[model samples]
Target: MEGLSWSASGRDIVRDVDLEVRPGETLGLIGPNGSGKSSLLRCLAGIRPASAGAVRYDGQDIRGWSARRIARHTAFVEQATEAETDLRLGDVVALGRMPFRGRWRGPDRTDREVVDAALARLGLTGLRNRAWRTLSGGERQRAHIARALAQRPRCILLDEPTNHLDVRHQYELMDLLAGTDRTVLVALHDLSLAARYCDRLVLMHRGSLVASGPPGTVLTPGRLRGVFGIDAETGHDRLGNLTVACRGVARDPA
Candidate 1:
């Protein structure tokens, strides 16, 4: 995206933001809430038209493509969502194949196979026939991700996929995404996870880009204090995983 901007009710939500994700790379977008991370993502997915500038996909403008056409290449997993309680797990995942099927047509053997594979990938195969409401919060989140992967999109855009997961599941999810060959663009609040899992990081503040680069460069103490208002220490752990240890919140200047 070049010179991207978005607004609502006469106020700009995202301003002059520019960013790019390389093929097969995972880029983590990090910012405080209401910093336009979600808005910027929607524009990239073609769900919301940009108020200014242009978003190009594969060297072509994204505006020319229809919603369904865009879905073929990008799958979006919205933040803080709850799966329908009445629906079976498999039924929810099958929705991801919507882009490839005719509306009037029913699921074919291929669609079922894809849905099963996605569920299994997320370790939800045992819950495939279970009711959605019966699953725990982490289970539900994983199921939602399974639905997105079922689309078989080249790029997956996720808005805080780990919001509901436990510590173990959070690590598992990050590792899963890190190992995938697909291009991933995820919004994350956990700086440590971003540093550990993402190949690149984009830091946003008040709807503008603060920094964009590898984690080592982007998560410096200066940027952390300036952008996040936190006194932090960042370095590799004993196992060589990047880690961020925060001292405390920065007090407002007198």
Candidate 2:
């Protein structure tokens, strides 16, 4: 996205953000709540129209593309999505195949295969027949991810995907994203997880781009204090991963 900006009720939620997510890389968007991370993701995915700026895919402006055409290239998983109907888990995930299906056609054999593979990819094959509403929060998250995977998009945009997941699931999800060959942009609140799993990090603050770089360079002690209002000690962990330990909230000098 180039010079991206979004506004609501005359107030800017996302301001003049220029970002380029590299191909085949996992890029983490980290910021405090309401810092416009989600808004940026929406603009990047072409879900929410940008107030000012252009979102380009493969060197062409995406604004000229149709919605379904955009869907074919980019998959987006929202922060919170729920299936209110009587849809089964598999059916919910099958929604991802809509972009690939023709207007008059239904799920063909290949569509079914893709859906099944997505379920298997997220370890949801065992629960494919379960009611969508009956699943736990983490399960719901996984289902959304599987749906994105089924889309077979070149770029995937996820907003706070780790919500409601346990510690193990969180790590597993990050690992999966990091290992994938597709370009991925994931919004996250956990600093250490982003630092450890993401090839690069983009930190947002107050509707502006605060910092963007590799984990080791962006996730620093002074940045932690200024950006997060916490005093943290940052260092590499035993396995050479970036680790951060927060001491406490920073106290302003008189």
Task: Please write out the lDDT profile of model 1 over residues 41-160, one tens digit for every residue.
Answer: 888888888877777777677777889998988889899675456888888899899999998999999999999999999999999889878888888888878998999988888999
Q: Where is model 2 poorest over a 10-residue stretch in terms of lDDT? A: 1-10
Badly placed stretches (over 4 Å) of model 2 are 1-11
State every prediction's TM-score relative to the real structure. 0.93, 0.93
Please, what are the lDDT tens digits per residue for candidate 2 over residues 31-50?
A: 88888988888877777777
RMSD of every prediction: 3.1, 3.0
Go through the candidates in order and give each one's C-alpha lDDT: 0.85, 0.85
